[model samples]
Target: THIFGKFKFQSKQGSIEDYELGDLIGKGAYGEVFQAVHKETGKNYAIKVYDRYQMTQANKLKSINNEIKIIRRLDHPNLVKLFSVHETVTNIYLVMELVTGVPLSDYIKQK
Candidate 1:
């Protein structure tokens, strides 16, 4: 989906020089996801920023680490591709391919 204008999602780290973040697309218990573009390549991607503070309380760091490991191993059309991960002292940034489609809840309601 195309979101116009600038919107800042919460990031533990100040700002990286490489990416320009746009509107937020999704949020979960752990963190928020935003639409981002790379400065050099001009490639669009979904940037998932995980809140270390929240995740630590839930003891989910290992699970998140495992998920990253599995995602790195994947290579298929049906699976979402993970590009790269950026690690900070307080947050984990997962750079993934942006997939455009309706949410399952919305699709079910339509049906």
Candidate 2:
């Protein structure tokens, strides 16, 4: 079976004209996260776009599925909220709330 076959995810494959993508915030094992702002709502969000080809080959489709499931189940103030997910032909974009805080590593080093 093909990877990502179980889940039918559709990405907002529109041009970059809708939102302003800012500086890179963090990079993880799967992909990079960026600070972004919605042009119409003026809302801030962190966009995490994963590398489709790499993820598929690595068979980490479960990770992507789990992320969506976990985010959907969570609803608490202490938790960062997941706004939406857009899956394109080559990437999966996860739109999430932007939380401003010092990284744990930075905080630990200061103390």
Candidate 3:
């Protein structure tokens, strides 16, 4: 069973089963973010999937939870809006607005 990159079908929060997984758009220290489409709505979203093992080892549990709390309240054009949260035993998923453009890191480098 892979903990990284792979998504789990079983869940309690929101089910990843609702979304059709697509190519990875970005990655962080804990996991990767992928482009996903709602199986029912046909709408695209960016799903940030984090590995629980890496998050625990990196000690990001508190910060990650805090970020989720803060991000949920925020709504802006510049910010990617959070739609829903999903979790399986091994991974956490954040479904967010799909903002297409150059990667922020690449854009910063170009500037």
Q: Itemize residue pairs with steric clashes in candidate 1.
A: none
lDDT of 3 by residue, 1-111 (tens): 423222235545347889999999998888899999999889999999988888889998777777888898888788989877766778888888998999988999999
Q: After superposition, how far is residue 97 of candidate 2 from its true place, in Å?
A: 0.3
The most accurate candidate by lDDT is 3
lDDT of each: 0.75, 0.77, 0.81
Sort all candidates by lDDT, best to worst.
3, 2, 1
Q: Least lDDT summed over 10 consecutive residues: which range in candidate 3?
A: 1-10
- TM-score of candidate 1 versus the correct structure, residues matched by position: 0.79
TM-score of each model, paired residue for residue: 0.79, 0.80, 0.84
Which regions of candidate 2 are displaced past 4 Å?
A: 1-17, 108-111
* Cα RMSD, each candidate: 9.1, 3.5, 5.2
Residue 4 of model 3 has an lDDT of 25
